[model samples]
Target: MNRLLCLLIGLLCISCTSVAQKEKYKKEKVYTVSKTNAEWKEILTSEQYYILRQAGTERPYSSPLNKIYKSGTFHCAACDSPLYESKYKFDSGTGWPSFDRAVEDAVDKDVDYKLGYARSELLCATCGGHLGHVFNDGPRETTGMRHCINGDALVFKHKESKNE
Candidate 1:
């Protein structure tokens, strides 16, 4: 019985070490647009602060950007970093705005175990704001990767027509 107890304690220690390392990495990583929680709250709406700063998700189908099909760029609402082009946007029927791909180097990815499983979490490279997750299931004709993004974490900028 003591041997089994020792093994269990060893497993627990390993798990705790990994969790501490992840927390250390998060605190050490710096973003170009880093700001304090109070400062972020001052600039972002409550929903935006929740989604971007606290990694909270907005309710599905609640974002107007989910249905926007206009020609434009979807930028990080926290830092105005251009992320997804409208050409890559698609209706995944998942309620959130879905994109086939993001603009090159505009976003970063990390593993998320928040839902008790590993998921690819997407973040704004410029600000480290949590945008959403990427999945393997997407249109096969394109990148075959669906970047499921939170519309509340984005700001859509309409592309300018040359007519003006």
Candidate 2:
């Protein structure tokens, strides 16, 4: 009877450890744009600092970028790294700027459990700033991934046509 109890306790410990590990955020080796907190604060607005530096979420449908469908490249507001091209942008109706994909190698994903649930948190590879979360329920015709990015974390550059 004692042997069976010991085995059960050991199994329980292993499972608990795995769960704890899964909830921890994994850090990347190096970010291209590193800055002090003071420096970042000087450059970013209050809302941008909250969303990017503190990992806070913006209110739904509050961003003007939500309605912009113009052709352009969206770059990280903090570091100016190109994140998503307009070609991959989509209206997911979730009230944030949704994209099917990000530019190749422009972002890194980390496991986040800030809200008591595991989520894929997108970060700027250049500055390690938090962008938002990525979900699986996107357009079936494309990657089927909805990168629900925070607009305060991005700056759009309108691509001018040659017709000018």
Candidate 3:
């Protein structure tokens, strides 16, 4: 009766408030390397454009960068900003390249709700390109953060030999 209707209304208000708070955390950021969509498409391949500019995810295990264990820095494909180091990369077996941590100040994070739930979305700090998501379920020994990133968003630059 009246009590039931009041309870339902209260619950609805609570849910709406929570959703608003979550949305507030994902404020849009101005990046150092902003470019028009056409400019981005010109420099990026179709896959890169999709993942970086449009916030699309590449199919897991599709990137050749997954198996690479060489010493190198993973750079953002859009702006060539250094992100994760190879030394921190690990086989999370989730298909995409996983890193325990990112280079300091190299990336930014925001909450994403594309999957009907909140996920910590990682982005290149320089270009604001979507890299992937970060999770707390990572190696407990180190930072305990898994920066699960899309390979199409990164370019690997192998460390140069000192002899060269």
Clashes of each: 0, 0, 0
Residue 147, candidate 1: C-alpha displacement in angstroms: 0.6
User: What is the TM-score of each predicted model, taking all chains together?
Assistant: 0.88, 0.87, 0.88
Would you give me the overall lDDT of model 2? 0.94
Worst 10 residues of 1 by lDDT: 22-31
Q: What RMSD does model 2 have?
A: 2.5
Error of 2 at 35 (Å): 0.9
Candidate 1, lDDT over the whole model: 0.94
Taking every candidate in turn, the Cα RMSD to the unseen true structure, in Å, is 2.2, 2.5, 2.3
The reply for model 3, stretches above 4 Å from the true place, is 10-27
Candidate 2 lDDT over 1-164, as tens digits, reads 99999999999999999977865754455887899999999999999999999999999999999888888999999999999998899999999999999999999998888899999999999999999999999999999999999999999999988873
Q: Residue 144's C-alpha lDDT in candidate 1? A: 96
**Between candidates 2 and 3, the lDDT winner:** 3
Could you tell me how far off, in angstroms, the CA of residue 53 lies in candidate 2 after the best superposition?
A: 0.7
Model 2: per-residue Cα lDDT at residue 142: 94
Ranking by lDDT: 3, 1, 2
Point out the higher-scoring one by TM-score: 1 or 2. 1
- Candidate 2 local lDDT, residue 136: 99
Candidate 2, clashing residue pairs? none
